[model samples]
Target: MVDKAVALLANLSTIAEGRLAIAREGGIPLLVEIVESGSRRGKENAASILLQLCLHNSKYCTLVLQEGAVPPLVALSQSGTPRAKEKV
Candidate 1:
């Protein structure tokens, strides 16, 4: 169920409005948490959403950094599943 929700958010994040909405709704911290400890697929989806949120957007990137996403993201990139690493 959590994985499904993260996947849905990942899909939603593909759009600019959805990225704004998710960021505005305080989704960054949750995504960072998921990257830290979610299931494999959930980590992948969460990382993908975070990437989408940060893409070419310094504000969102700052928010993600402020939420301390980098450490978990780096950990995921190094040790998460293949798809999760790709997302990271």
Candidate 2:
């Protein structure tokens, strides 16, 4: 269920409005938490969503970084699937 949600949000987050809406809804922390401890697909989805949130937006990028996303993002890039690595 959570994985599905993450994936849906990931897809939606591709757009600027969706990114702002998700971030406004406090989705960043949830995405980070999933990156930290979710299943492989969930991590991928969450990371993808986060990437969208930060894409071309310095404020969101800083927000994601401040939320402690760097470590897990680095870890995912090193050990996650190719899709996940691409998202990172």
Candidate 3:
């Protein structure tokens, strides 16, 4: 099922990426919680998601940016892996 796939994809590393990839497709709510959850992995994932959302959909991109995810993303962009840097 799509929900299972979605849930399965939502781990510490992938949650942000996955949410950004699927946010407007019904992922924003879930990702919001993760972003505001105060977990390191959650924040990292949320930042990644926000950047990816911006890359594909300017509208949602604005939304993510407005949510204040850019700072953490900027940090991640500096030291994250190649794939991680690419996403942010």
Candidate 4:
């Protein structure tokens, strides 16, 4: 339970150093749920992770769009802090 919660909290995005690895190998549904339902920190982190994946992995970016992530990321860009906007 604790491991699950921690994974949910971070959404496999915290490790920006390994963006492609996480996006390609980890569970997308978990990250999607975090992006959709988590706190500000969570959403921001998810966006950063997505940005990295979107930049580094075409397949992941396609998945990100197919999963309807752009609208929320755009919405976040509008109201989020500068750093957040830059990452997303």
Candidate 2 lDDT over residue span 4-87, tens digit each: 888889888988888889988998888999999999999999988888777758898899999999999999999999999999
TM-score of structure candidate 3: 0.48
lDDT of each: 0.90, 0.90, 0.55, 0.66
Clashing pairs in model 2? none
Off by over 4 Å in 1: none
Worst 10 residues of 3 by lDDT: 4-13
Looking at model 4, report the run of 10 residues with the lowest lDDT sum: 1-10
Top model number, TM-score:
1
TM-score of each: 0.95, 0.94, 0.48, 0.67
Ranked by TM-score, the better of candidates 3 and 4 is: 4
Deviation (Å) of 14 in candidate 1: 0.4
C-alpha positional error of residue 86 in candidate 1 after TM-score superposition, expressed in Å: 1.2
Give the alpha carbon lDDT tens digit for every residue of 16-63 in model 4: 555655655764555566666666666666666677677767887888
| Decoy 4 TM-score against native | 0.67
